[model samples]
Target: MAETIVVDPITRIEGHLRIEAVLDNGVIRQASSSGTMVRGIEIILRGRDPRDAWAFAQRICGVCTLVHGIASVRSVEDALHYPIPANAQLIRNLMIAAQFVHDHVMHFYHLHALDWVDVVSALRADPQKTSELAQSLSSYPQSSPGYFKDVQAKLSRFVASGQLGIFANGYWGNPLYKLPPEANLMAVAHYLDALAWQREVVRLHTVFGGKNPHPNFVVGGTPSAISVGPSSQASNSGTALNMNGLAIVQDVIRKMQAFVEQVYLPDTLAIAGYYKDWFKKGEGVGNFLTYGEFPSEGKSIDDLSSLMIPRGIIVDRDLTKVQEVDLRAPEQIQEFVSHSWYDYSTGKNAGLHPFQGQTNLHYTGPKPPYEHLDSEQSYSWLKSPRWKNKVMEVGPLARVLMMYATGNKPARELVGMALSKLDLPTEALFSTMGRTAARTLESKLIVDEMQAWYDQLMANIRAGELETFNEALWEPSSWPAEATGVGFTEAPRGALAHWIVIKNGVIDNYQAVVPSTWNAGPRDTLGQDGPYEAALRGTELADPKQPLEILRTIHSFDPCLACAVHVTDPNGEELLQINVT
Candidate 1:
């Protein structure tokens, strides 16, 4: 049997993944990605009110909290031809932008950074030298020698405690780790700093949506009203978003922009400099997909043209040409369950559009305590989704490439700056390290734009336009008998879309083709490998017992197993369990 590796997410463990790799002469010859759990949220959504869909759908992935809700509400609004107020659009933009910045930064410092940084190595670093190195990169305030000493001390205590926890001193002597002791210590300090910084940044969500980790979202517009102007009620009086709340949001945006500019962007480039060889490997299937998001003022949610991140597709790593993406067209987007634990009314080989997607459970693998999954048959729970019969990669890499190909001036400039700073060519953007770099560059671009979104929202308040919810479609009695629509967003992880079919004011069918599923799915009917499988094929594992290289490439894609493999039974019974022997 080939070696089976179970990779768990940093935040959660139950919803994890397994990978089977065939090695030939120290290099991976083939790979398979298996989402161990199955998602049944779509099955649960059937026969529910379309307007209440966001509340339940938002629970799909606790980490990617707001995007699902946003997509769910927009899907219903699209089916009902709902148009929200301009102020509402700006608020949603701010909320979504906050989600992006928050998600990316946390992923970088907490999850992916450890793959390249060795925390145990930090114990050998000189605090003064680490401080000097940090000062040379960016003028972040916590670059003092004393600050480094304090961080090193805390990290040392954590390691010596013998209860390392998640930030444990893992892989102490791994040879593949390229960063120096000073660099590692600097990264470790920043990781702890980000943990504290994230607390304040999330206040933006609380100020706008009442809570985080699934903030409130309505189909037509925002859940809160504007309580602006001095003559009106004070801030936080009832459900109105007053000036005080906006001020808090503005402060959070400033903090986010500052952190990205000083910590996240510099740290990424610094780490990439030491691991330049990674740029030559880990390229996925040369196709990219992005569903545009953050529509400008007075623009429809379905309109991709005016989006901050334009919707488009890039094939064969070609930056010169970008094809249009039509989500609603049946031929444009499809999901196949050929190698997944699911059944379709049509044959397994048939690819169905999201509007007609199903969630039938059918596990066809070895029982628990098995050595490995049979790669030739059904393995993963995620169904393979394709665009025009072409396998595509979705996420930060795709978003950056699409923005660059479509000639978005800021995206182009940021990509150029990152490449030039790293002294790498444009073609390097397709590699595993390049994928990680693209994530950082996009974070910088998104954080810089947050100020403008906030400014516009405040400007609308000054103009006395305080309406948030659209009363036009609040009542289900004004609904059509049957309708279908697709709502999409360039989520922090990748392109995410929620498809809804409404009949008699209730959801007849609902499907979410999330980012993780697009990038972490299994092989299709034609025997074509999915993005994760294709990217892992040529990976040269330094040590079979400790395949840190595989983890590096997988983390570059930032796999969210929960998003890909979700679950719940019709009768709330435990569906399946696998015990590793």
Candidate 2:
């Protein structure tokens, strides 16, 4: 008898996903990850000025929309070889940092916490005890006894308001939720605090991008002008000696720095201690990868004038045994459409870059046509991406290992400190739990760097390096008529890259190999499963109908929509295509 488990419309995260697991005994034998809703943004981008692509791409995802804007601009810049000033680099970094802080905090509390902390359990919490715990954790914000009572009262009111839309049909009261009622109450209180903090960080983007959800950044530099005297030309001039504008952004970053160190990091550690089992379970793809990030001052990883973290791949039984990366090598990356709706030549060995990409949806039945394919193609619109012609994992696990191997001293030291805090031996960094811990650890490192960068900007400003912006775009002819460039950056989840081909001032071809394409991919031609697919095979299902364990494991990676992946239904009314710039 095949055991069947179903999770209808998974809650707490963006978009829609439904999981149906076919089980043999207590283990998942087959799993289906369904993409539940349709949002047509790509179809919307067609026939518009490629210049407006970033603006529309940003709307594809509200949480990481800035990344889309950044990627879009980078793609254009790549096509043009537009050189951005030092000030522009600093400004872009600041915007990305703000998004990182905002996304991580909201993800932890608003989305993932309800799975671990029982909301209904909070009703039994003692307000006095909660206050005492808060006081004990000095890293957290100070609150008086009455403040704790007020927080509890507000939570009660909010709950009674019947506005638990985010928490609707949550996994509350599940036995898997292990935190005590007091702990749950404390977390619930922090959830509210996180909401406010997230809003504050979002301002960092507003100051730079003009709006949240999607901000505007120019190809040559930022849209905002640096204030230096009355003339607009002076605003775009480099700060050869002045340092005023850099200081403004630097100060804002400092505020965020203090919050993460004194609040966010400590909070994650505290929460992790209560959920120690996560360290052992849900470990997928021990091999790690990073496309490098945040270029160091004066160094270019791939010959790009801008600073980049570095790019490399590591596969070893031991974490320390990892090696350097070679992104230039062909055959390292491949895309499989065997089970997808697309029509492609079978077993063809060729580079299928995004510009030469193909996405033609076909449906023969619920079951895919290929013999190696799934019995039911009832799920996601995302196609599986593989490395070295095989499915490989991506994200924190990949980033942590890469950072540990090729990153600066600070990144390495931060990883070391995280391992120590978890009480696992230093070598334990090689496990699944280490991946989760690495993200929290790596975030701290990024936060610290952001603060220092801010201080550097301010110091330069105080030295009279203040300017509003750069005007590299003034001479459009400076750009080549035909060019190809790759824009790669570290999104909050993992490595993200965009490749663009430009001809006659328009995007001849554009492609994005998103983080999800690597982590959530399906099986390849060789019959090997992707990271998410492999991870699901070993998970024990208590009830096939409600597999919380599987959901918890897969969601840890936090999959985002891939712009290049699309499903088409010829019979449907006009094929839901989105276009907004």
Candidate 3:
């Protein structure tokens, strides 16, 4: 008999996720990934002003706050055929690049490192040996023996105090841990460094958008204006985009570059050396997709050739040929909710594109606090999203593969370097570890590119080009009676797109197929498993009780369920509530 194991409320992720796997003699025979919440943000956007979509859409996920805001404004701009100034385009590029670097560093060190680094073992590491190993990796400037000693002492005090704080509830002594105590101590030290580093880097968003999470965005262009003089209305008394502000932005970009080169990239290669075997496991749905982002020129969105991250699809692990994606094609992108807690007016088995998507809740699984889900019926809140009727994996791996396939120089160089360092072939870039390393390499690529963008913005400013917002399409009466558009971008996790329909300058319909929805969705109407389930199907668990292997693969995708589903109650009353300390 195949015994079932349930891991509900998977910890250290953004929102609630439950994984059910059937183990036959220590090997996973099958698996299911479920999102336990429902999101009605789309429903809330209906009948609202199109200009206000960015404000509401940004609230989709607290972690991925800025991506949604950018997508929302782009959707409205695409619908109205609004063309923003070149300076605005450059500023937007810089902000998005900062978000990628900041998010990837935080994800690797804070969110995903504990899975590989055993904090309990760090106390046993000799601080001198750890310093030697850290110095061998790169000149990070904080690799002194005293620094490691302080970090190890901090870990010891936490253990002795019986209050682990964020380190609580971790599987600290799992046998699968591969890094030496020295390596573990090094990772822990950088993890603390990243926390302070991210706080300073995010000021780029604050300088440009006036806030960090949920930054302000406009439909026509960015909300920021170039500061030419103190008398300019856009320039405030404290500090705006003035010369001092520009210098601060430049300094932030340099800091981001240094961290990726010294701390983030070198740490990934060193840790990857210890777990080369992981490069062969957790390969999910070889099909990859990216909507392409960061336009290199001030061109129309229709011109895919100018994008820094090329848009295309790779099927069945074939990289020789790239299939073009058409977001406007009705049959290209569709969502199916057969195994999800939702109904479509068309039919339960039908697939609807975002323009015609529906969100009618229909929960039929066992009620809350249950031991196991009845997998035969609706088992999750996430709908299965498919491209051309096939499961596709999206995120760093997808973008990196797309860049390599398209002959991108920077992507190829970085990937080639990382693979050479680990002594692995290109094929190794398809597994769980590859997914994590890809995020790091992509960060370096983006950080390098940021310098060119910043230089361009400065050149434009020196040339006296200060326009940022396009007010030509600000009037509601200027739009046609009905218009629809799709905004697509490559988020830190994967491809994110928002589709909107406008009637009389008001939103008639809105739908977002977030990156997490693509990776964490449930089975489709045909009973085919999504990426998360497919990845876990054949994984070998060393210890079924701990199941650390399961978390390794899932966290590689950086699952963000909060973006996929939201809370709702059809009975018009609070179903359940709890107070936490």
Candidate 4:
């Protein structure tokens, strides 16, 4: 007999996620992932200006703030064949790169670190030993014994109050956590350091986009104009894109690169030295997908060759040949609702492409506040997004593998180095720890290339190329009666795209296939489990109650259910619908 272990509302993630793992003989026999909420940004976009969609769509998830704007604006641009200025493309690249570095660091340290590091165990670590461990790893500035002592003292206070604060609700004494006390203390200290590091680095977004966390964006290009003058537009507010802002942006990139090299990358490798078993677990559908991201300045988006990260499909762990991906092909990508809480006109078993995508809400799963979700039927709010009718994993692992398969020298060197350091084979890249390690590897690769992008921008400014926005397709009079487009970006989590149907200058239909929807969605019509479910299969539990092993694998993908799936009551009644004027 198998017993189902339900972990409702998986903590430290972006949105509502419930994991139901059926355990037999202390091993996971089957797993079903459920996104407990749904979002209607697609429905809200209908009948609105396509240009204004980014404003509403950007609110899809605060953590993935500027990405939606990038995808939305690009979808409209793709539809209209709109071309932006070279400098605008450079700025967008820089901003997107920053988002990746920032989001990845935050996810690893804050959201996923506790799964490995025990804060309660950190209190028992000797400060001197911790300082030595940190020094052996990287030349990070905060590795002094006194610094570790102070951090431990601070952590002690959190425990002393019978409240661990952010470190609360953790299975602190779980046997699955293998990191020694010294390593745990080192990780805890760096976790605090990353918190401060992120605070200053996000100013890069403010410098380029005029604000962080849902930065202002324009359809044609960036919103800010390059102003060398002191009295430029918004100069009084310090939001002007002037020499001062440019200098700050430069400094931010340098600081970001330094942190990744010194703290984030080394920390991951050091902590990973203890948990080698994880490299064998959490391997889900060997097939991977990527939209390919980070284009060069002045390069057209149509030129896939210009992308630093090559986009392609790796089917069944075959790294020898990378398959080409076409977003416009209707048969290549489609969404199914067979096991999700939505409906299609063609019926529950049919799949619909984004151009013909619909967002008709329907709930057939057990009502909320219930014990178990009947996985035999609709069990999740997320629609299963499949590429060529095949399940694929997305995110850092896919992107890294894409880069490696495409023969990117830097990625290859980094991947080889990480493998050598871990004493693991290439096959290990498919595991739970592999997904987490790929993130750090790609972050360093992207940051290493950031200097050139900054230098090019400075050269462009010197050459008097100051335009950011293009006005060719700015007005409705210049637009066609009907047009359709797709915009994509390799978001921090994975490949994210927004599709739009523009009619008479207004959005007629819209669909967004977020990364989480591809990963966290329930089973498809073929009865194949999503990445979350597939990864959980075969994972054994030490203590069924604690289930720390489950958290380790799931957190590797860094679930963002808020962006993946929705909103509504279980009774089929709209609880709240505010019409935005």
Local distance difference test values of all predictions, in order: 0.84, 0.62, 0.88, 0.90
1-581: candidate 1 lDDT, tens digit per residue? 45445443222222577787888787788888888765678878999998889999888888887999999888988888899887788888889888988888888888888889998899999999999999999999999999999998988888788876767535667999989999999999999999999999999999889999899988888987888656255643776788888889989999999999999999999999999999999997989998888777746666777887888889998889889988889998999988876668888789999998887654343433335667777777788999998999999999888888888899999899888988899999998998999998988988888888788778877888788888987888888899998778878889998999999988898999999999999999999999988998888888877778887888888888777864434455564565543
- Cα lDDT tens digits, model 4, 3-74, are 989888788999888999999999999999999866888888999988899999999998987999999999
* TM-score computed on alpha carbons, candidate 2: 0.86
Candidate 2 steric clashes: 27
Poorest 10 consecutive residues of model 4 by lDDT? 572-581
Ranking by lDDT: 4, 3, 1, 2
User: Once superposed on the true structure, which residue ranges of model 3 sit more than 4 Å away at CA?
Assistant: 230-240, 297-300, 362-369, 574-581
Winner on lDDT between 2 and 3 is: 3
* Tens digit per residue, CA lDDT, model 3, 1-581: 68999887787789889999999999999899989756689889999999999999999888876999889988998888888898888888888889889999999998898888888889999999999999998988999999999998998999999988778888998888989999999999999999999999998998888887888888888877777775455456443477767888999999999999999999998888888999999998899999998888455455689888999999999999999898888898999988887678888899999999876655544445445766777778888999989998999999999999999998999899899988899999999999999999999999999999999889989999888899999999899999998888788889999999999878998999999999999989888889999889899899888999999999999999989874366775553332223
Task: Write down the TM-score of every candidate.
Answer: 0.96, 0.86, 0.97, 0.97
Better of 1 and 2 by lDDT: 1
Among all windows of 10 consecutive residues in model 2, the one with the lowest summed lDDT is 367-376
Residue 497 in candidate 4, Cα distance off native in Å: 0.5
lDDT over C-alpha atoms for residue 246 of model 4: 90
Clashing pairs in 1: 38-566, 39-566
Residue 536 error for model 2, in Å?
2.3
